[model samples]
Target: MSARGFAQAEYEARLTRAQALMSKAGLGGLLLTTEPEIRYFTGFLTRFWESPSRPWFLIVPAAGDPVAVIPSIGAALMGRTWITDIRTWPAPRPGDDGVSLLAATLDEVAEGPVGIPSGPETHLRMPQADFARLRAKTARFLRDDAGITARLRAVKSGAEIDRIAHACRIAARAFARVPEIAAPGMPLSQVFRRFQMLLLEEGADWVPYLAGGAGPLGYADVISPADDRPLARGDVLMLDTGALWDGYFCDYDRNFAMGTPDPRVLSAHDRLLGAAQAGLEAAQPGARACDVHAAMARICGADEGAGRLGHGLGMQLTEGLSLTAADRTVLEPGMVITLEPGVETGGGNILVHEENVVIRQGGAQILSPWADTLARLA
Candidate 1:
């Protein structure tokens, strides 16, 4: 058996917490197919999920431990987890592909309504046809448990917080080295590659996301992939990364001026920083997610065409509790979220600033160090 990342007691507490929620909601069991949900319960971590050929399932009964119904190939890894009731079937089997096994497992575990995540920010991780087949075979009514899972996962455990904080520190060290690795005239693609390497050297297990833009006054979009366009002396360059440590992620970004940025860009950067500060000040327990949004929106102004001021961060690059007017999730202690404020800087270009923090009773505790001022790279 392989070593487990989380202690057995941690897994038990998570299971107990989820089961309590399930019972309260009148759910007989929860069928989790997504990566985060499965690993959150079972401590079964692997990067083999890159292949879309197989489907894995975890059944958390309202009364007992979770059961793993997965591809036969993963049985050994599953064995290493705190979960003991492991069931496997040969996956990628043209038609069945563990659908029957999953259905049977669900039927055995649940007698009434079964809960699954089918709502916002969640995608059914199995093949569509297989899902239909499983539903038909099991004949169990499935309810949307996305909200229950979201509420449970939003609060970071002490260990989860430490992992995320470590990842933030690693990324901060890497960002500090960007001036030595990146230079004017270098293509944005090379900058991306070198920065990813730097992150690994700084102790990040993997760099899943690295996106940014470089232009005379900020970039057109924050999510655009790095292009071959060379960085110019007067350009404002931004690099946002989602680096992972122990399956937890730190989503944050940094901005740097190649030589001298436009004064408007500098002003926009300062405004964004102030907006983030406002958001942080409002991120105490009992505050709603939208309250944080309003605080930042007041500083940055409304409708700059940016989607959200910030969002909950953990398990994935983005998660539940969006920092927008529509999201009313209470900012409870232990929730880790990002404060991202974006400003449009004319000509379809925009400047974005981001920082990660853990919500505390007192206020927001910043995980990543703030970029005191816009970095100027020679």
Candidate 2:
């Protein structure tokens, strides 16, 4: 069956969180640009890059219906969305008061500074012009409001968990077919395509935005598989993908070898796997996020410190809690996180290990079946 669709309850929960965030940020309203925030508030999903005629923005006030502002062409789609208010705009003209329109729509309800979802620049979605227009009119633009949503989003509602697990099951089954699709002499790109086809056959709504790459040390600079270079016997393949369903993300990464990997590679893989285990063990309610990172680092053995152990995963790939050094976020029940402890050796050997976990009363429940050992394709 096709992956379970987004439940209406999930949408309501997200909106409630957004409203709470608006209150906490001291903003009369929030303007959600073309990224996850817009999708979260309105359940509006479209080809974000293709629609450039008029930008799609979601106006979420502390109270009342969420108003979706988009180009006239997208109005139909927005109308079908769960959000109640759908506003459309014509293509901006020479004297178009695009900024004025935004102010007019928001000025009535919003007072005080409007909070923008301005996380790290990479996470900000909308074009520079629209972002600028909103900023100039709003007294204050804030970053990290993602928490307003992330805190709510990170905890997967029971139904949302079902959809994610379904997605993970699809990916796990797809990985089982990796050996068949991947050949000793096939290019990394070709292997990735086959992996994607398996996913599509399983009825994925869309191929995940993420992709993986593999090669010898020199070629391990992972790319999006546009370069379909064939694999060699000595190649180490990196398989990383974010499979999505119902707007939620199932993220995990694995490493494989076309043939028997070097002992150095094998050792590193084992170390990372151990680190992952340590991180999972530390993922209990009341545990801090950095404490999870510490567990993984200690297991990696001195001098073998892997990168940040993992991060929170849900609506957006990387969300609220991050398992990295210096972050002191406390873990809570219902939080879903990814534990990825990895190390890349100078010689080109890369060891990647990851799993999706949900914090539980007993400790942590592994959402995805754990991979037992390094997968050797050859």
lDDT per residue as tens, model 1, 294-324: 9999988755566898898988999988899
TM match of model 2 to true structure: 0.87
- Colliding residue pairs in candidate 1: none
What is the Cα-based TM-score of model 1?
0.97
Clashing pairs in 2: 186-231, 187-229, 187-230, 217-348
Each prediction's number of clashing residue pairs: 0, 4
Q: Which candidate has the top score in lDDT?
A: 1
| C-alpha lDDT (0 to 100) for residue 219 of candidate 1 | 86
> What shift in Å separates residue 233 of candidate 1 from its native position after superposition?
0.4
lDDT of each: 0.89, 0.70
